[model samples]
Target: MTVALATSLGDDALILGQRLAEWCGHAPTLEVDLALANIGLDLLGQAQFFLGAAGAAEGQGRDADTLAYRRREDEFRNCLLVEQPNGDFARTIARQFLFSTWQALLFPDLAQSAAPAIAAIAQKAAKEVAYHARFAAEWVVRLGDGTSESHRRMADGLAWCWRFTDELFMDDTAKFRPEWDSHINATLTQAGLATPKPVRGITGGRHGRHTEHLGHILSALQYLQRVYPDATW
Candidate 1:
């Protein structure tokens, strides 16, 4: 269960990190672009640590490289929200706010997990995610309450992102992960951010079903590896 949970969380970070990297040069402003890049790097670093630990815990020869570069699309465990394209600045901010908020809540609880290794990763990741959540919350408020144009875009972005919010809270695994849902809601509420009600949507990422974007993302992310199977940097 420790290995499985850690791997799933790592996959979430990996996929979302790739998606955020897509905005490196395309964000609306230089500052926002740099901010997203920093977040992407943070996620990537977390993915490496978590996936590596998961592999070790599972007693598998596989490591982060194998898990990240060689996994098939259907084997990825990222939520659908992360794989969605970075539509607009507001859309990106909305996605960040929602995911970071969820991660912030989830990690702190996981930090106390019965699994020591998992708890360690969660403890370390919780700190980084706290900052990420703050960054996202600030952007959400700035855009949401900004000028008329910014407000409109932020609202539209929130609407688009709201649909995916349901999947985050649905734990079909019955793992009974304690306090995960309530913790997230309370944090977001305190921050004056609202997440959509926990209505189930098409949810299978944790079970290895992924969005169509996963294939495309894998193609690009693994291109160098695929092209030069025997080469290393």
Candidate 2:
């Protein structure tokens, strides 16, 4: 169970990192591009730690790179939220806001985990996730209240991203929904945006079932390692 949990969390970070990295040179502005790149690196770092821990737990001697670069798409256990296409800046912000909020809530709990390694990783990751949540929240408010077109785009982004929110609470220990709700609601309210009406969430990613997007992500992410097995700097 510990291995599974670690692998899942690692997959979440790895996939989201890849998504954010896609915006390295393409974000709305130079500052935003750099910020997204840095966030992506943070997530990738978290993924490496979690996957390394998971490899140790599995006792297969696979290590992080082996687990990450060699996995098939169906073997990945990231949530559906992270794999969705980056539709627009607003949509990406909405996705980031929803996910980073949940991560901020989750990492604190994991920081106190009985598993020592997991706890250590969580402690370090919690700080990073907090900043991620703050960054996303700031953008959510900025775009949501900025102007008519931005407002429409932000609202639409929220709605588009809303269906994935419920999956974040599916873990029995993930009981922070109320806190998440309060935080998100306050942000939306302040931004003059409506909280999205709850919808039947698109689930199953945790079980290795994913949207088609994950396949494309994996193809690109694994390409270098796949074509040049074990080639190193």
Alpha carbon lDDT of each predicted model: 0.79, 0.93
| Candidate 1, residue 208: lDDT | 76
Clash pairs detected, candidate 2: none
Taking the tens digit of each residue's C-alpha lDDT, what string does model 1 give over 1-233?
A: 87777788898899889999999898888998899999999999989988998889878698888888888888787788888888888888888987887888778878876488878888988998999988987877777666788877776776787777666776643343244456545544553555554444667777778778779999999888788874676
Off by over 4 Å in 1: 172-200
C-alpha RMSD in Å of predicted model 2 compared with the true structure: 0.9
Which runs of model 2 end up more than 4 angstroms from their true locations?
none
The digit string of per-residue lDDT tens for model 2 on 67-155 reads 99999998998999999999999999999999999989889988886388788999999998999999999999999889999999999
